[model samples]
Target: MSAAAPSAQPKLRVKNATKAYNTRSGELVAIDRCSLDVKAGEIVSIVGPSGCGKTTLLWSMSGLHKLSSGEVLLDGKPVNGPNPEIGMVFQDANLLPWRNLDANINFPFEIKGTKPDRAWIDDLLGRVGLSGFGGRFPRELSGGMQQRAALVRALSFKPSVLLMDEPFGALDAFTREEMNQLVEEIWMAAPTTIVLITHSIEEAIFLSDRIVVMSPRPGRVAAVHDVPFARPRSLEIMSTREVFDLTNVIKREIVGEQKSRYVRSSDAPVAQSAV
Candidate 1:
């Protein structure tokens, strides 16, 4: 028998990753010596308290933010600039109100000086359950529908990795849940390594293969949990004991970080300046 082809390598590897910010007050580190490896076709979610630098980490990985130290490798290559192999989805959808759904989804193609692939756009929209709404503008579509279009547009290029930052945070609870299910279904249809940053433990558990819990300001990796759940997951699974166990574990990590942060703040010496 012929030898089977080797499987592709992991999509991203972040090692000794450190990111810092400079301010008039002083320099502050956002991410300190954090590291994680993302395998091909796996969904990873980074969750942490406010100001924990989850967004910073994602932007650094995406090449939008330059790291102060360490490395972010995508497909064995350093991520120093925009790479077409990656696509990003943000919280606001950022779709132009003037553009119709099809036009908006095809915007990426247009920017590349390529003609809008109508059939392709239609196919993607159909997959997101917005089959007949292509002609509607962003104003006409509900929050969830707008998000679906945003995701379809991000995938229009068939990127190997998708980076999302709280893409459903602006939606209502019901809409967010529906959008989450839609994303999971989309992942089933077309597998891609995804890195998502979310504030909700439920959303993280619902969508992630691994939950990377982050520490408070000057964040570090506090814990990395391999979700003990099977694929094709649904909201129904959230009610299970196993699901609660995982969720509770993640929540405790965040809470622990918060408590530690408060204690540190309480013990800090008063600020002083010399003339």
Candidate 2:
């Protein structure tokens, strides 16, 4: 038999990543020896309980936060600081109050000392349903519209990897669903590697190729699930039985971690009293 071809290297790799902070009490570990790998053009979502270091992991992947140990690599090269190939979208729109939508979207180009692509920018705005509204300021747009602009801003530079941290957490249910659909459409149109941090199990199932569930504080990867659904998924798919079951499975992982933490804390006092 002929030798099988080797697997392709991951587009992004997190090797035994550990992040910590020095506070008044001492060192605080946020993520403990967590590692992950993302293939090219893959959409991966990380879901966990609150304060489980989901944001910290995302930030480390973006090179915005320095890991206390191990390393993050993009295309096999270490990412020690912000790189043009990586783009980030935070929970807030964070658009410049004074700059109009067009200018705000072009801000990355300005920082990179490159000229903005007007045609591409127009197409992005159109795809996100903000075609002619580019000339308006952020104050003139609604929450969803502002977020659409923020998404465009991150994509304006055509980064290879996009890191999103609860980008739609502030939106209403209806709006959030719409934004999710919009994200699916955009991602289909232009396939970019994406790593998303979200608390919503349904959102993770609706948007990701795979889902990574993290444990409570000092977060570690509790479980990793490959979404069985095919691409170009619609919002109606969220109502299916398979999706419901998968959502519950992911939810149990998070809730189980929370319960374990509670048990550990509760048992500590009893053991001390027994002594």
Candidate 3:
């Protein structure tokens, strides 16, 4: 294991968590007996194949979904429902069409009927490079800019944890890269524990302090890798042999787990056809 965080207790813990749904066929287990810890001020990326419960885990972390077994705890408190300290940014911008960027970013406070510190929001806008665009509508922005706004909106509450579900998955390659850099910048400016669910290996490597690799469906912790690079990392680090080797190691683990899954399915007995 990598060196423990300076603090004694984890900021977030997912312990033996399992999530399942009762379907027509049977119980569908999305995640099984998964356990992990994220330290305060850390950025952790959860990467896995589709149907591997990456999003399920994100929901659990955010207190939006309850686990079938075990639990997710934030600051030693159980996450049984949507907690105020947690903020989520989904795959889509999910912006209200009629609301201007400033209004949309302030929507969270509006719902709570709470007044927010406009100065903080302004600082965030500047940090995310959206300083002057707050008056613009969502439609006026490009895909990347819209997503950047989405991120700022999530942070406007100053939540302790930010749960991102493939926020850049829909963007073009260049836009995605730009957003990745933007995320790093934002995190550095104002630290928060972040849990990002993504399929991009390079993105994970670039943004995370640690990368948690999940197994195939009924996902479990396949491996946990502590990113060796120093923070305020740049895209140049992606070209190094160390990054390449680490990427290959994760790929092999996923591939190997998939092969095992195929073998198990093939070994199951087939039902005989009726006469």
Candidate 4:
């Protein structure tokens, strides 16, 4: 299916974005004319090869790194730098060890010098299953728990757009799946536009409304896929023929090779819009 007409102004718009870095060897183009539009409350995932400019594109979107050319806009306004409306979560939780869970999650509020409501913070904590551990330190939490707290902390201010760079990359298989479930739950509870960068095709298919596949090195949009599944999706769906076929399509888009020994059924249509 083709991309649907956006219902409203995109929460985030990356317009012909390009980034180049000066290396000792020469000027290297990290990303070339990559563009994307993410609607409000939508979840989009980006996947590509290891050397692709996926992370660089994310940094530009977050305004952490300026684009060499093109622009990133939030709510139709140019994103020149870090905006309060945008929240970011890195691969590492990066929680302050000196502080307790409450303080760690409240760091965003503290930076703004605003006292967040105790009840609200408690509710956010509870959403991630950290209900009774507000006063506990980061050391007391597991890897998944720490990541959960990180997610809550990022959402504390009710940002319109959330940028996540492989937030569950460090976790084991079980923990990553748990985090994915937690994120989906929190997203349904409080909808926000999310742009996630991940290397795993299965993770992208399981979590995103659309998946953007990028080419290697000087990254470019190779294909865009619309996930044909309803929300409140279960892990069981991942094993379905539809999902497995879609995963292979994305893999082939990224790698340009097909290793699946099974032959494609004529009924199976590779649903993707090639760029």
Highest TM-score against the true fold, candidate: 2
Q: lDDT for each of the candidates?
A: 0.85, 0.90, 0.89, 0.85
Worst lDDT window (10 residues) for model 2?
A: 1-10
Structure candidate 3, residue pairs in collision: none
Put down candidate 3 lDDT per residue, 1-275, tens digits, no spaces: 23465666898999999999887666788999999999988899999877789999999999889899999999999999988899899998888879999899989998878888899989888887899997899999988889989998899989999999999999999999999998888888888999999989999999999999999888999999989898788889999999999999988988888788777776763311100
TM-score, candidate 3, is: 0.94
State the displacement of the C-alpha of residue 24, model 2, in Å, after optimal TM-score superposition: 0.9
TM-score: model 1 vs. ground truth: 0.92
Q: What lDDT, from 0 to 1, does candidate 4 have?
A: 0.85
lDDT of 1 by residue, 21-130 (tens): 88777777888988988888889999999888899899888889888889899988999977788899987998989999878887888788877667766788878888
Q: What TM-score against the true fold does each predicted structure earn?
A: 0.92, 0.94, 0.94, 0.89
The candidate, 1 or 3, that scores higher on lDDT is 3
lDDT of 3: 0.89
Put down candidate 4 lDDT per residue, 50-153, tens digits, no spaces.
76789999999999999999999998999999889999999888889999988888898888988787776688888888998878898998999999999988
Q: Judge candidate 2 at residue 64 and give its lDDT.
A: 93
Please report how far candidate 2 places residue 21 from its true position, in Å.
0.6
lDDT at position 168, candidate 1: 90
